[model samples]
Every structure is written in structure tokens, then in C-alpha cells.
Target: MNKTIVLACFLAVTMIYSCKKKGKESHPEVKVVFKKKQVVYQVFTRLFGNTNNNNKPWGTIEENGVGKFNDFTNTALKEIKDLGVTHIWYTGVPHHDVITDYTEYGISNDDPDVVKGRAGSPYAVKDYYNVNPDLAENPANRLEEFKALIERSHKAGLKVIIDIVPNHVARNYQGLTNPDGVNDFGANDDKSVAYRVDNNFYYNPAESFKVPVFERDYKPLGGDNHPLSDRQFDENPAKWTGNGSRLSQPNFHDWYETVKVNYGISPDGKKDFDELPEGYENEGFRKHFEFWQDKTVPNSWDKFKDIALYWLDMGVDGFRFDMAEMVPVEFWSYMNSSIKTKNSDAFLLAEVYNPSLYRDYIKKGKMDYLYDKVELYDTIKHVMQGHGKTDNIPPIQEGLKDIEHHMLHFLENHDEQRIASPEFAGSPDKGKPAMVVSATISTSPTMIYFAQEVGEDGSENAGFGKPSRTSIFDYIGVPTLQKWVNDKQFDGGKSTEEEKALRDFYKRLLNFTINSSALASNYEDIHLYNRNNTEGYNDKVLSFVRWSTDEKLIIISNFDDTNTYNFNLEIPENVIKKWQMEDGNFNTNDELYNQYSSSLNIEDSKGIINMEIKPLESFILKIK
Candidate 1:
């Protein structure tokens, strides 16, 4: 479906309130236009506002203070919005298993052996109907505090997105706060059989669950003394691990902390649930919901659907599904279609890396967006590492031509290595050119992890998770981001000069992307044209053109970190004729540097643009 059509439908359904005219010469009714390009800011909830400097490897929650739901004040949210953020993905919001005890609040204790770290893995969801108690001011009112945060985010003109780990749940699955009439996962399962169409989890009939043997210097509870940390968990029939490992004792590298949810797929990889009828993709969510009303499907599907609707009703704009491909695409089709029936504009993004399944998930699964990791992100990383060529980028964009707009672009997220870490680029400066190309190469949503602006190298040894990627499993504080937080000031007062400069560059680039009409319009790759026409243009340089009815932009980037390139970029005769450019000299201004300007000579229906691009720099030239 076209985005314009979707937006129009959403507006028609949602725009019902009209302003009352109270006086003569009433103020002109302002019209709001949604931008085609979106910017997502992903922040790990546990560490976003923590100011503690203690980052011990396996530190307790007391040793490293956790950021509360109230930490995202209006001032902080406004600051984030000013950075050109349209949506704030509040990661790790759902109630998950943790080492801390919340038994006083009617929550059962989670054994440390089944949890990942002191804080536990956010992907290992414990309860679908409650918010993480560690994030609330009062453990009794955790859900209310989260609802208030959602309201605050909307008031600040930003949408809220939270994670939905539908593929799996914490090993010790317990839904303490489920709504009335809703049964927990596996509540009606028969453990005697290993496969059942209506069962919630896949069982190992005769095997008992065993904790994975710890290697290296790690222990089940990080060597901490606790009665429940005896390396034993009670499960009569061991369920499959989150990663599909059938072993009763999963290896340390496996996703041992989580258990896979069964979605009516039998042990031999056959789907047993009722499939959506042909031509269902073109139908609306209401139609899909009505179709499933009387149909008998797996119990797990209904449970997940209820969980999703609950969050949507609580004012969350959308969800970011974790490991989405692991679940059956049919389930997503049913769930997401139902969600769209409630709110057509809900931003549904999934983490799907398989290129083969990308189209299936987006079209058949009813997902709005999928991560562009295997192609765009990996290509950029290779180019930044100096082993790949810019020539590889144009083909990727061409390959995903039909669904390019549905691909979400990002350099860093919760699961990926930071751009400035030693395992990646080793410096944030290397990401400047790559980021520019990533943002302007297509009309997709771009995302940035928290503290990526100030170059947060996730180098801490935060228990279960090592360096490179920030710790999502431990009680820890991000080093560089902590300075910017500056004890809740959110002003970056303690940032170094280099750090501030890096952040300013990101701010300028992201803000420009959101406000530019050409970027949100049409894209045409000029890399092949330049590589063919220009003599000195190398693989280290990339160029493209973005245009709309009223504006046109020529974007060029130098991916090389230590060399400058001076070349005459060429515009094909076909493009010049399409734009109806007259045979005359045109002046161009750089939107990125503002101080740089160059002349473009158009003769005989062809244009020659001269550029001297610095190392790791990009130029967004506006035709005058």
C-alpha cells in the first residue's frame, strides 16, 4: 500500500476535532503535514538517566543506580525532539526477569540461574501485562508511571515505541498482572505431548530443564551468594530454547535465558494453524480481525494479540518486534492486521535480517518496516572498515527498489556494535560520511542509538555482555552518555570539545534530513554515472540525486578517512532533460557546510559539477 494512501486514511479516521471560532478574524487554521522521512531515537531504558559512575562488571542494582520512568522529564524530551527525533523507542520497558526481588508487590522471585545478568535481558520478557518494576518510583504503580511517560512523550510532540518480544519469554514464564479472562502462556498446555496445535510452548516430553554450564570466569549468579542461585530451575518438561535449540541443557552461547513460544508449528517444521486466505494483503485489519473471530487458532496467537492491544490502548504509538523472523509470519499477519484496525498509523517495525524473507514479512506479515541490516548496514560497515567499495551500495538500493521506503536504516541499535567502538570503526568520525549517505540514499526512516551523537564507545565489561555493544543485560551506566546526562541536566555540559563537535554534526545532519523536501521525495543513484564519466572519481566516493516537484539536491560523500578527492561529478543528459534544465551556468550551495559554493555548467543538455570533498565529509548541494 502507498504511504500517502495510508496517511490519508489515518487522518480521515483521527482528525475529528475542530477548533471553535470565538472571535472575529479567527486565526488561520493551521494545517499539519506529516513528513515522509522519520527519525527514530532508541534509548535503553535502564541506562538512559542513570548518573552513577560505578560500572563494575557484575555490579548489583544498588551499586549502579537504575534510571526511573520519571527520568525522561519534559526538558529532556524536548531536547531529544530538538535533535530531530520523531519517535523515541523506549527499549526494555516490559516487565522482565531481574535479579532484584519484588516479592513484596505480589511479584514472584525469579531465580538468578534463569536470568541473564544483574538486570536480566530485556528480550527475556517475564510478564506481558505489567511494566518493569525496577523502572518505577513505586513498585505498586509501575504501569501508571509508564502510562504517564507515554502521555508526556505525546505532549512533547514525539511518538513512543516499546519492544515486543513475541518470539520468546523468560524461561520462568509468569504473567502476574494479566487482565481478567486472559490466560497466561502455556496455561492450558498438555505437557505429555511434544507437539500440539493449540499448545503455547514446545515441550521435551521426558527431559527436565538444566542450566547451561558456565565457562570462563562467570557463574550463574556472578558468584554472588543466594539461596535461589543453586543452578537449578524447576521444569517438568523442558521447552525449546529461544534460538530453537531442543537440548534440555542449552550451551552457554545459546539463548538459554529464554524459552521459545509455540505458534502451532509442529516439530517437523509444518504449520498447523489456519492460514489467511488469498488476497488478504489488500484487505484492511478489520477484515482480518473479523475473519479470525470464529476461527480456531493456536492459543499463543490470542495471548500475544491481547498483549499488543493492551499496550496500544495504553497510548503506545507502536512496537519494535525483537527477532521477529523466528515467529511464524502468519501470526504477525493476524496480530498486526488487528493492530492496524485499531490505529492505521501505528509504526510497526521488525528485526528481520534474512533478505529472502524481507518481502514476505512486509507484505504477507502486514509489517510496516524491517531492519535494513544485512544489506545497507553491513555494506556501510564494510566500507567504513576500508575493505569494501562504495560501488556496492547502488546495487543494494536497486535490489530493494519496490520496498525501499519500508526499510529502516541505522548504524547502531541495542544489538549492534557502536560505531566508535574498537570492534567497529574505532572512531565516530568514520561514521560522518556513512551516516550522510545512509540518510539521503533513500526515503526510509533513520535511527540512532542513545549517546551515538557523542560517540559512546560501549567498552565496559558489563557482565554477560562484553564490549562493543552496550550492555543490555547488566546494571551499568554508559560512560559518554553519562557526561551528557550530567546528573539529569541533559545539557551535555560535561562533554569534551570533540564530543560536542560530534554531537553538533549529528544534530545538523538529522535536522536537515527531517526538514528537506528533496530527501523525502525521490531518489536517483548517480554513482554509476559519476564512475563512468568522471576520470578521478574512485570507489571511495559516492554521489546521488534527490528531487521533488519544487526542489532538487545533489549529495556526495567521501568515505575515505585520510584522503581528499577533487573531481568533476557528472549529471547524465537524460537527467538534465528530465529536469528541463536550460543550457546555462547554475550556482550550487552546500547545505552541509553552508560556506561552500560551486558553479555547475550545463551545456548541450549535460551538466558538469565540480567538487573538492574533504576526507570523511559530505556535501548536500542545492541547485540555485
Candidate 2:
């Protein structure tokens, strides 16, 4: 009897242990610090104050410097910060030139920003080490203004992210050289080349063409057959010219926006070399070898890692990598790891404009976040155009699930068209509600482009034209901009009465998102909500639910010009607390219970709980 009893006890203990092990394996909670998972507002410095629509020539960096990012502090940006944005991304902080030459034809209205000194494209960075003196704090103060801006941002409790162009550099800045004429740039021909501080390089998948002779101060390089070396390294290596692609062509120097890289000739393809040729390998092979060539940009990996660390050390939470697709996945993976180590809560958002490009970034864990351009584009453009409907909502919600941890959602970014006006073919007041609905309710982190809050509007051409428009924000201002920022009102337009109501509505939604675990939920389930059978429930009504084991948030946005929709929600009973509309209106007690789980009419124009939408509008309802 004693032996049997002992054996039974041992088996029971083992069973319990097995169950516990399985439980642990079945589900693991995420360990992430969401400092501010609410909403983030973006500011494009050039367009903050003045209404410069045409990128017309500004006097000089000296004259325009005051209007640049330096102006962002007091008005638009400050307003946005006050609106409760947890993060701010300032575009074009580093110097960028709009490389068009209007001199021969005379400056036209379409020219963006004129070449004050030597206007080159912003993407074609002249150098990373130096700050655009004009854009800095004092004319000669250097990185001071940039640093001060960062300090101010921190004091406001907002995390700031600046653009980093790791893939390319400027074509016209002249070679980095000493006053005595020593080509002391990163492209020196001697053993001390690695130590040189003048030149920069990018990762070359198929190395081609040798490093060209450095040309100083825009002086002509006598060498022929070299590509501009400013544009993207060719995807097709067979296109390489023996000497260099662009330089080899006559008059190629006239076009200074892009350039090809340097690489040695191979029977198969062009091979990149940092030091002198292989047979003449008298120099230190390891140090001199250019890592960016097929293998990796020699020290680029370390350099970027250090850059990430430097920014974080200075109290930045993360970086929004530009042109991420061009760089090697290994570079981002290393960067992501290093930044997370320094600040585990760091938000690494990659600007991989296309959703198809998100695979590698997601798989390698190289990026913790990416822009969800697909859903946003469809919601703002197609849906607003009256093409797709509510059924179209499923795919977007599903896509967010797959990339939830690394997703940043938005209706309009600096790259795309504004959400209001011609883009939506609706009034600024009408289009705004839909934008807010889409942004706040989406599973991904929301990003509000600079002029978004105030019902800003413009055309696609406004983004990249001539020297006329100083900044992107100069188009139009709607009250939504200030209201969302100051929390004084949620009004989508210029009306004061509407602003106060809208403000409360917005606050309720924002607070709900921040407090609940739904915003952080990554569940990809699609069948969880059903609105197909209801009348007027179509693509016009965008709806999705984000839920974890403990919490859930149901987001519904109407993109119709003026349509009433009834949609049914399948949710657990006793979850909803109160219904909060965009105008600070609410329904509770008996009214809520009577409408529970039923299709509620949304009458946006009538100021009633009817599901009637008045053009572009968004809604947020709180669950008890």
C-alpha cells in the first residue's frame, strides 16, 4: 500500500509540472516600454510660418535661416507639442538643396528653393559631419541650434527624430580637401586613407568602377567614364562603364545630382576596392578594404551603430531610417540591436514607403516600426473617392497584425498628398474627421504630418517643385491643427463652438488608447467583427478591433462625403462604458443599452448619435 501511494503522488507532481511548462510555452507577454503610445505629430520646418507655396529662391541660407527649423519652436511645432503629441519628427533638418538649375532659363515660379550658394538635392548630402551653417543656431554657431532644438524637444517631454541619409552624399560639395590642396578626404590614395575625414562611401552590392580622383570646390575632374556617384548604385551591375558610368559620358558633369560608385573590373562583375589594386597590395588589407563593397561598407556598420548610440546617449528615443531599402539588412539589424541595448524603449521606425519592402526589416528585427502606407493610402484616397467600402477594411486590419510591433500608421505623411481638400475631393472640415478616425483607430502607431491637425490642403506637385514653396505646411490651416494640439477643442475647422466640442472628443479617444492595452494588441484575427449584413455598412465605414488577452479597442471611421451607415459589432457583453463622438457628445445608461451590439446611426451633420456621416468624419466609443 505504501509503495502504491508514493508512486501516485510522484505521477501527480510530474503532471502538474508538465502543464506549467506547456502554459509558459503557449503564450509569452511582450516586454516593451511604450513611453507614449498615443499620437505623434510631424513638423516640416520650411513650411511652418510663412505661406511660401512656390519653392522660390530664398535670399541665402543667411536670409532664409530664420525661417527654417529655427522658426518651428514658437508656433506650429510648439502648438503641436502642446496638442499632446508624444513624438516629433522634423523633416529636412540637415541641409538639402533642390538641385535644379534655373540660371540659364531664369528662375521660374516652379523652382523650389534656389541654389543660394550651390543648391544641391537634400538627399545628395554634401557631408554628414558638418551642419548647414545657415540652418544652425547662430550664423557661425554650428551644431548649436540643432542641439538647442533637441534640448527644447526633450524639455517638452517629446522625443525628436531627425533624418539620416546613410545611402548617399552630395555631388557638388567639392572633394574634402585641406587649404593646402591635400585630398585629405575619405578617398585618399595612400595608406592613411581610412583616417581621412573628407570623403564618404555607400554599400555596393556589385562593386564597380574604382574611386574617381577627388575634385575640389566644384572643379572639374579630368577623369572620364564616372557616373555622378550621387544617385542610387545601379541595381543592374552590367551597366557599369570601365572608368565610371556617368563620368565616362561627355557633359555628364553638368548633371550633379547623382554619381556612380568606384569598383575594380572583374570578368564577372565590378568589384569594389578601398585601397590600391590587389596585386599591388602593399598597404594594410583589412583597414584599407572598403567594406561597403559587396561584403559591407567597411566601417559603416560600426559608424551607424555609433551614430545610433550617440543620438540615444543625447536622450533621443530612436531613429526613422531614410531609404532603408538601399542599405544592407545587416546594417539595420546591427543598428536596431545597439540602439535597443542603449535604450530598450527606443523606437526604430524605418521609412520603407512600400509594405512589400517590410519583410526583411520585420524578419531580422532590424526595425521595431515601419509606416503602414498601404492602408492609409487606400483609406484616404480610394475610399474617399467612393471606390472601396467597409469590406475593404478587413485586409488593412489583417496586415497590421502581421507587422504590429513594427508598424506606424498615418493618413498623410510628407511623402503623400494631404488628407483634406483636393486629395479627398471634400471640404477641409469634412475630410478631417475621417483622417483622425483612421489614424487613432488603426492598430499601428499614428503619425500626424505637420499641417494635418489644422485641415491643411495642397496638390501632389506642392511637395517637390521649384524654389517657390519654403515648406510643405504653407498650404492651408484648419482649426483641427490647433485644437488637437492645445486640447482646447477638437473642432475640425475654424469654428470656435465646434472646436471646444471636438477637443473633448479627441481627448477622450486619446486617453482611451493610451490607457488600454488594445493599442498594443497585435492579434491578426479578421472574423472578429461582422458588419456585412447591415445597410449602408460598406467601405465608407472603416472599422477594426485591437485586442489582447485582457483588453480591446474598437475603432470605426467613416470616409464618405455624407453617408449614414449602420454596422454591427460582435463583442463581449458589459465591455462598453460610454459612447464618445468627435464633437464631445456622448450617450450612456438606457440609451447605450438599447443600442448595444446593434447598428447605431451616426448622423455627423445632425449632431446626433445617428450613424449619419457629414462628409469626412471619425468616431471613438469607449467600452466599459
lDDT for each residue of candidate 2 in 122-227, tens digit (9 for 90 to 100): 4544444434433444534545677777787777677887666665444333322122432312343222222211223322324332333334532211121223
Least well predicted 10-residue stretch by lDDT in candidate 2:
11-20
* Backbone collision tally, model 2: 78
lDDT of each: 0.87, 0.45
Query: Which candidate achieves the best TM-score against the true structure?
Result: 1
How many residue pairs collide in each prediction? 0, 78
Q: Candidate 1: give its CA RMSD in angstroms.
A: 6.0
Off by more than 4 A, model 1 = 1-35, 282-287
The deviation in Å at residue 482 for candidate 1 is 1.1
Local error of candidate 2 at residue 327 (angstroms): 1.2
| Model 2, runs deviating above 4 Å | 1-36, 49-78, 97-120, 173-186, 189-256, 259-297, 354-356, 421-426, 459-512, 522-529, 547-553, 566-615
> How many Å off is the CA of 143 in candidate 1?
1.0
- TM-score between candidate 2 and the true structure: 0.64
**How well is each residue in 225-337 modelled by candidate 1, as lDDT tens digits?**
98899989998799999999999999988999899899999999898878888876654455566777788888888889888999999999999999999998889988987
- CA shift at 484, candidate 2, in angstroms? 12
